[model samples]
Target: MHQLSRRGLFTVAGVAALGSTGALLGASPANAAVPDSPRFDLSGAGDNPVAKKSLHANWVMQSFAYDNVHQHLYFAQVNTENSDRANAGDLWITKTDTEGNELGSMALHNFGHGVSIAVEPYDGSVYLWTEWMSSSSGFGTRIGRFAFADGTVLEKTSSAVQDRTPSIGDTMINPQPAIDPSTGRLLVRYKTGEDQPRIVAFDLADARAGRLATQHRLAERALPSRGAWGAANPFQGFTAYGRYAYLLEGRAGGPSYISVVDLNGTGQSTVVDRWETTAGQSLPGREPQGMAVWMHPTGPRLAFGFHSNTGGVRQASVFVKTQFV
Candidate 1:
């Protein structure tokens, strides 16, 4: 996602090279996917644009992941800004090249709001790893894996769907999936009935093979309690990278923030780093929405995204943190 090359150059950390699975498999891993330092230099980061042309996406972009294989970017957007219709699990996935030229789009019916999405490239084809079976809250009740077929409308009950949702807790609600294409690792962020939010890590291969159902995991870490980010800070999005995971939080006209978590670390304070980002201040209605690790040809990058309403149409933009200190 690093292309300050005047707002452009890279892949989503070997992503959808995780291209819905296989592509992200060979995605390069710098510092073994999870670096000891979850901290990056935000002060020096730039608001590099990933999309060149205007987005054809219909709603506000929620989360996105990369596909290094075909050099495409996948964006997830939910329909209806109204809180009531927001829970319908209906959203559009707009596909585009790294330069932001809209190529095509897909509609997911009754799929949870696209919190976080994983691109897995498998069998010369691509499979999108996302939450499925929208619950009452309009979030995915389980993880769904399916092909990225353009012009296709997939129902939550579609047979082509693969239920990748792991049996985490007795009442796991709204599970989210993030892929560390760098290490082929997957993180599922979920909340229990007690409202305890947690992130569990697993190998992407094992996860794709259904081994997570048997309790095979690399590590588990706790996310901040609900509203812990703050009463005004809305939960935005998250992504997995090697032994670490990253979270995004903020709202329109922000002060957006990025928090890094050590997946393999056992410390009580799993959040080892927190920093406020002013990377996209120039954009109007700059609400932080997406984050992903990208394997740039030059080096490793952490990509963040935002949304703005331009003349009533929700538009999306992206920025990357290329310097890690």
Candidate 2:
């Protein structure tokens, strides 16, 4: 993993401000028809409509989860450290209200790099997916569960990687867990090559028990096009609402988009919607990372966390939006 640093300057813009000239693609049997991208209109919500906030500079926002039951936004931050050495950094999980009010926080010592987070609505338990390196275990990833009320770790289950040769240089990209709100089934994305990423489903019972579950590949249409932006756009973060799964694509300083798909029991996924962030829609020169969704008084709202460097200061920020039906 690369450390956060001050880099080039990129102007920030709004997704809603940019109008679409034509549809990128239409929906099919496995994909939903393309819909107009969500507009970042602050007028409807009144002044100070967009809830923007900054996190500590030492922390890099990796993933996010929202607890609808408790109305809390959970942010997973990984302490920045050199990845070449066995010395791993701690992981901090912070909770805040919908208005960006700080509620509480929990710190895990040498807990590895937190990649993503999800909250179980039924039991209010928080799950954090992490990757780390150790002398004995080599490179590994695990899913950790914590109590939502007190931030107490309940259990952790290692995600076994097949034929994974662990090394200091080995880096893996895993999307944050996508929980099915209706069934509480957790969906995790994993890929090793150029092919479409695989989706693994673990029941809440199995996850709480620390058991491994079945894995399957998402439908081809469900996967993002590799050369969409002159490079392979890997899945950066994930969230699920109703029967659809939302995927974050592209990297910081580049064009980014969100792909929504209908997930099925047979592992086949149907693309429903795709919203690309207009150039300059995010924090200047920052890349969008983890995302979470929740219900607002006006309607359902989506929140995305970003990492960027401005004025020689490396910072983490979040932008929330609504009006994207």
Candidate 3:
């Protein structure tokens, strides 16, 4: 998927594009026809609106992913000289009740942009990936596994690739990560700013072993552009079920769809379904960061979150769907 440009200069803040079955198909009635909106009533997901924005602060709550391992949520909070002084404002994981109260908290370093989260079902640990700047001033991606008592972390450097720029801070950055339950290996997909953005895969099973097991290239395709300046264009989201992986792909001019692949072995991903975004478009703001995150054992439905920039206003949305296929 192509990175859609913003109206003004790009800031350090991360933005995500959203692609849903309904939005991509332009099927307003079908999306509208859902018999029931998400039952956030039980999970206490919808009852609370962040009373004080400062509680979440510079932290975009949606950017963080859920830790189904411990039934908690994890996010980062930046501590500048101006804010709370005692703490440097560290990365935190807190237990989320239906009421949105802070159940427990833990601290981590300042890991900035391109943050993606996943939960390891086998051990009930939360995994987060983001770019970290070392004291010497070099930036690299690190994967941290946060647990109740202790944690395991790994600093990642891309294996030498001929086409892509060596894993830099903000170039064609890494795409989101998805885990295959059957294989017990972490698959990280990334892109390089080549003629067609080059997508690479890394295996997280062996941090001690720094080589990627499988690497494939996403066929280069130009994206579709949204109409108007602030339209609801689509972005990508991913989820894995059994051996099948689902990917939401968006184009600049107009095409968008969900691609399904057998990620179990060395087979090429094929397009199982296709879709388009809502019309009367405008430039889409940040995509849905963790809208597609899911834990297979906790629930059957695939859970997705949406932080909508409706008419330039940020509105939060979450979706849970049972796979029809």
TM-score of 3: 0.48
Compose the digit string of candidate 2's lDDT tens values, residues 99-118: 65567765543444555567
- The C-alpha stretches of model 3 lying farther than 4 A from their native spots are 1-55, 61-64, 75-110, 121-127, 134-176, 195-236, 248-258, 262-269, 273-287, 291-293, 296-299, 309-316
User: lDDT (0-100) at residue 111 of candidate 2?
Assistant: 40
The global Cα lDDT (0 to 1) of model 3 is 0.34
RMSD of 2: 10.6
Estimate the TM-score of every prediction. 0.83, 0.62, 0.48
From the highest TM-score down, the ranking of the candidates is 1, 2, 3
Worst 10 residues of 3 by lDDT: 1-10
Q: What's each prediction's clash count?
A: 29, 9, 19
> RMSDs, each prediction?
10.0, 10.6, 13.1
The positional error of residue 212 in candidate 2, measured at the CA in angstroms, is 4.8
* Cα distance off (Å), candidate 3, residue 100: 5.9
TM-score-superior candidate, 1 or 3: 1
lDDT of 1: 0.70
Give the distance in Å from residue 188's predicted Cα in candidate 1 to where it truly belongs. 0.7
Query: Compared with the true structure, what per-residue lDDT tens digits does model 1 show for residues 211-310?
Result: 7753565565456554455557776889865656778888788688887766644332445445788776777777888888776777667888888776
Candidate with best TM-score: 1
After the best TM-score superposition of candidate 3, give how far the Cα of residue 273 lies from its true spot, in angstroms.
5.2
